[model samples]
Target: MDFLTLDYFIKLFNIILIDLVLAGDNAIVIALAARNLPKEHQKKAIIWGTVGAVIIRIAATLAVVWLLQLPFLLLIGGVLLVWIAYKLLVDEKEHNIEAKPQLWPAIRTIIIADAVMGFDNVIAVAGAAHGSFDLVIIGLIVSVPIMVWGSTLFIRLVEKFPVIITIGAGVLAYTAGSMLTGDPFVKGWFDENPVMKWAFIAIVVIGVILAGYLKKLSKNFISINEQGQLTIPDSIKNEAQIEANDSFEAKVDDQGRIVLVKVAKSEG
Candidate 1:
């Protein structure tokens, strides 16, 4: 099927799926980077941070796709993907650290951190799109805000409807399967038989499920408390409180890194 035909839509859908599927970390990073700012600056931080993220993502995707044209590069990408998958399963901690004061510095931190932490996403999206720039741009533009604003919503949905996570995992696995076929080592068989393609898809799907299940099992060993509000975490609660005392009726921790402790109005 030529990319100019109906397959274009399929490719576009796959690219968008890849973007949405991989956007959780981007949202978290943006939220965390801006979380430390005074409530007044949160919106600005998010806007600037998102702009930086979008720019960086486009550049990264373009660069990766360009490099993908090289001989044996797909094999290297495939190896990198294994590491990416392992990291996805094993690395649960957020990568972007909280920034201190100052707007540009925080924004810079967000961009840099996103560049590093988001490399995997870039490669994954590029591979899924299979060299379609239109699909890449469309996917990124459409999904960025959804990732930015709907992160909490996504989390809530995933929790309330556990199947959402399962479906997402399945998608990741399917992408991974497609990626494996494009690798230099396996590229030969990819065009040889339709059965091979289906088999690759099955393997990726099952691998992702098994890996996700193991990760879930690991989380079961840890205990997490339920919080009432979507406030920040405790580690930075005092800082936010101190900052909150100075002005604005309510502060937004744009970075979303801190765990907030709700203070009584009378206490302040």
Candidate 2:
């Protein structure tokens, strides 16, 4: 119980290390959930969402022992995680960013996903802490900054290379499958039948990825009509904040590429 002992510091370091490694999935969920929001509000969502998720983690870590005893806890959580991964993947769009996105839903997603996905972290940290609540508190305190930085970094990465979202979803699905296999009720069976465990994991991961890809690809097709005049699709226009009768200046650049810029209205 001594705060300054080497053992205390070692345990704290272990807790921090565990959290750092486990934080990637939480960061991805935050990024994917907030990316569709306006740039100004994305920061708010990231910060608030992370705070809520951390609070949930703390509470879960505290009750993790008892929570583990609850029947079907891992099974139910794994199913929910699979659904969340699928939802996050399919809901993302190239031109479907909302001008007025709901903040709470994104925060809610972050909290629920983090809580479900955090069981590993909680158990890992709890084992490291050796029942020391003080270590738990300090460890979570140190993790907040790391979690925020991770979320922002992922958001930028997703902006540049969107495949990360799919990868992230696969990661979630894999974790979910692992959770399912580890559930107490099923763990005995899975241990006796390891091949079935691998099959279940493969099915969950591939099914989520394929279903999300197909759903995302099902966006409405938009094309110019035969009149030679291009009309903007409502979804694209709304995403771009283009109003009816909006004027655009088109130019052919040195690369022989066409570019369009919206013209600002003049004051009377």
Q: Which candidate is the best by TM-score?
A: 1
lDDT of 2 by residue, 1-268 (tens): 9989897887687667556545644666667778777888888887888888888888877776356446687777677667866876766323222223677777776677667667667765554455578888899898767766765664566679878767667766776787678878988999999999999999999999999988766543345678868766565777889888788899988999987888999879
**Candidate lDDT values, in order:** 0.70, 0.72
TM-score of each: 0.71, 0.51
For residue 81, what is the lDDT in candidate 2? 68
Candidate 1 is scored at a TM of: 0.71
Note the clash tally of each candidate: 15, 0
Per-residue error (Å), model 2, residue 238: 3.5
- Displacement of residue 140 (Cα, Å) in model 1 is 0.4
Give the lowest summed-lDDT range of ten residues in model 1: 228-237
lDDT of 1 by residue, 23-106 (tens): 665777777787888989877988997899789999889888777767677667755665565455445454538765778888
Best by lDDT: 2
In angstroms, how far off is 204's CA in candidate 1? 2.7
